[model samples]
Target: MEPDKLPLVQCSLALLAERLTPRDRVSIVGYAGNAGLVLEPTYDKEKVVAALARLEADGSTAGGQGIELAYRFAERNRMEGGINRIFLATDGDFNVGVTDIRALIGMVERERDTGITLTTLGFGSGNYNDAMMEQIADHANGNHAYIDNPREAQKVLEEELSSTLFTSPRT
Candidate 1:
């Protein structure tokens, strides 16, 4: 049997879209094998939730595609003069395909130099890969946290909204 689609991840993404600035660019990175999965365009909460419902656990290669999509978005937005981040919402279990933790971390690290940060919101429990999620966030110069409930998602989004949106701290 396959795992269920995480509602918390969907809610968090929805909340994020609500808080994004007009200058901010939003992109989603979800599993490729999930046929009905579609990342809604920025600010489209209903579409995002609809897309999340169709998501399914595929393979580790899906994670790689997520990373690639994020990097490509960052590259394109390099000249936009605003915050750039890849908000990855996953269970963190990289299996059924190419599962090189190091390679994933390296890719995130390389992109960080270009001012692209990675924030991971982990979902589920049993199959969660805490180390990979945390390491990717750290190497990408960003942050990671698990959201098992809706309230936690709100806290993370409301409290860290500034940290997540603003690229630099005001001195």
Candidate 2:
């Protein structure tokens, strides 16, 4: 993650927290060299927002582990007919482990049958792997977006919250 793009990530997460209702269950995950469960699946907006605030753009990216952890959280607490999704905000760096694009895509693709969508919010420009993010999301039956500013974050997470959160974006 780019240090300069940190605010945009905060704004995006804040927007998401603001838009989530009591019915929605959210799990927050952060990854650098590995993955950490920032929050369990919960309806408490404060917990979710606080977890997002704890994320800092400092360290090597372990995107594969992060996605895997998010999937586990989603799968464990998955609702029968509810929208179970993993919302990844990153600079698209996968340096620490399982960096192979094919392997990462396959990891996510295999989880499609579980019905946990994987939406990626791309941040920053340098070293950003847009194609990989797009392909991962596409294969996981979800959407991909590049959020360059707070406004774009709002447009992606706030304005389109309903559609993006519950249903796949229309191609």
lDDT of 2 by residue, 1-171 (tens): 454466678768877888677888888888876889878878887887788778776668989999999999999989898888888888757888888989998998889888888998898878888998998889888888999888788788877766667654433
Candidate lDDT (C-alpha), each: 0.67, 0.82
Q: What is the TM-score of each candidate against the true structure?
A: 0.79, 0.91
lDDT of predicted model 1? 0.67
Alpha carbon RMSD to native, model 2 = 2.3
**Full-model lDDT, candidate 2:** 0.82
- Candidate 2 has a TM-score of 0.91
